[model samples]
Target: MEGCRNSKDYMMDVAGRVFVLGVGIDNVNLGEALKRIQEYVENGTAGLVVTANPEIVMLARKSPDFKAYLDNALMVTADGIGILIGARLLGRPIKQRVTGIDLTTALFEQAAAKKYKFYFVGAKPGVAEAAAENIRKAYPGIEIIGIQHGYFNDDSKIIDDIKIKKPDILLAALGMGKQEKWIEERVKPAGVPVSIGVGGSFDVFSGEAKRAPKWIQDAGIEWLYRLIRQPSRFWRMLQLPKFLGAIILSRLFSGK
Candidate 1:
């Protein structure tokens, strides 16, 4: 199916208010875009959201426990440019590549313009605060509701504080399955309207991480560059190849 732009489907959540993306297969919905922010503000639960690619989906299929996490996400935006191209190769055209970093940045820019408060949850120690500071410096007058490291036990006290502060936006960086499951489990029921699962965006926003240059991003070779930078990530990123294999294999089976 072609990406359904502006289409919304209410997802299963504590609040039953989540919306899934359709228009741009890779582009997630704004309602789901801001899920994490709303969760901390309303319920103080920070979550992980994954930018799932076909390979990751395949991986999930192999790991039923992990598959459950992926299934629980409020929304899963297709992040890889390859996913878009592969979809085309498979005869399904996805028009755009929506990244977690870009998505969160876009949402924040819009919220800042509207005088909204923001809470950045997740990221390694200090990453969230650095991202919050970077955003504040970039946009003067943006209310940074709060920031917290993504690592914490279920009993973390920041939850209570977040509920009290009530920021309009919350950006979570807990990464993939965990973040998405977090948002779906929280928010809406708590009455917070927006939460964004930002993955490693905190690292990029904080200068602790680096992204591919504009040209690389446009070329869809961002993965190659990341592989060069962090050879260690190679193992995990094998999901890309696995994704391609899944598509090819599926095609073969369908043709039979």
Candidate 2:
């Protein structure tokens, strides 16, 4: 709502349920968020995440439910440097970008420590298997109850599978807003304590797509690097200018 700068008022929306957080914040870092997420998982709780890409924040401004869902989310962190900049401009800057992918890795580590089981859901073809195998290799002894690719139509089907496994953590790599909506409607109400929408992170983690180097990520140029690496991103890149305009207009007119 308040230009995506308010972390205390975090959350974004979709058609299904309340997202616990929003973008355009820059206060929480991966370390702090890892702690918060650990607290939630250890206690059996749930939340949502929207990367603070300018386009998403801009979309949050235009979409009523998106803004409200984000506002109601339990945690929202700045996932992009642009959002950090926006928050600074608004004088309520968050401290760092909390990337969903990085958070997933941290969560896996924490789950390993706690012996928590995780469910890998969504993504096409070999992505899910690769991600699961990669995780198993990276973090030994963490239980992965089950794995399913993002190819189903009936949401109930996936819900049934997840209900059976009852993993402590569920990571949906269905990409962007769609992933949020899917989990909100199908996963959250089914009693999933913690479910997050990870956009294409599975691919990168699984080595399907090459992630940037450490320096590239630190420079906050990962996005640009991604766009350059993935030509398919050209269409997605088109969303930026539109999102940017929406943010400015929302600020000027007080769009909620």
Estimate TM-scores for all models: 0.75, 0.83
Ten residues in sequence with the least summed lDDT for candidate 1: 1-10
Question: Each candidate: RMSD to true structure?
Answer: 6.9, 5.2
- lDDT of all predictions, in order shown? 0.62, 0.69
Q: How far off is residue 249 in model 1, in Å?
A: 0.8
lDDT of 2 by residue, 72-149 (tens): 555666666666655554435466777888788887887767777888888887888988888889888889897888
Query: Model 1 over residues 146-185: C-alpha lDDT tens digits?
Result: 7789888772476666678876666777876666556556
| Predicted structure with the largest lDDT when compared to the true one | 2
**Cα lDDT for residue 44, candidate 1:** 39
Instruction: Say what the RMSD of model 1 is.
Output: 6.9
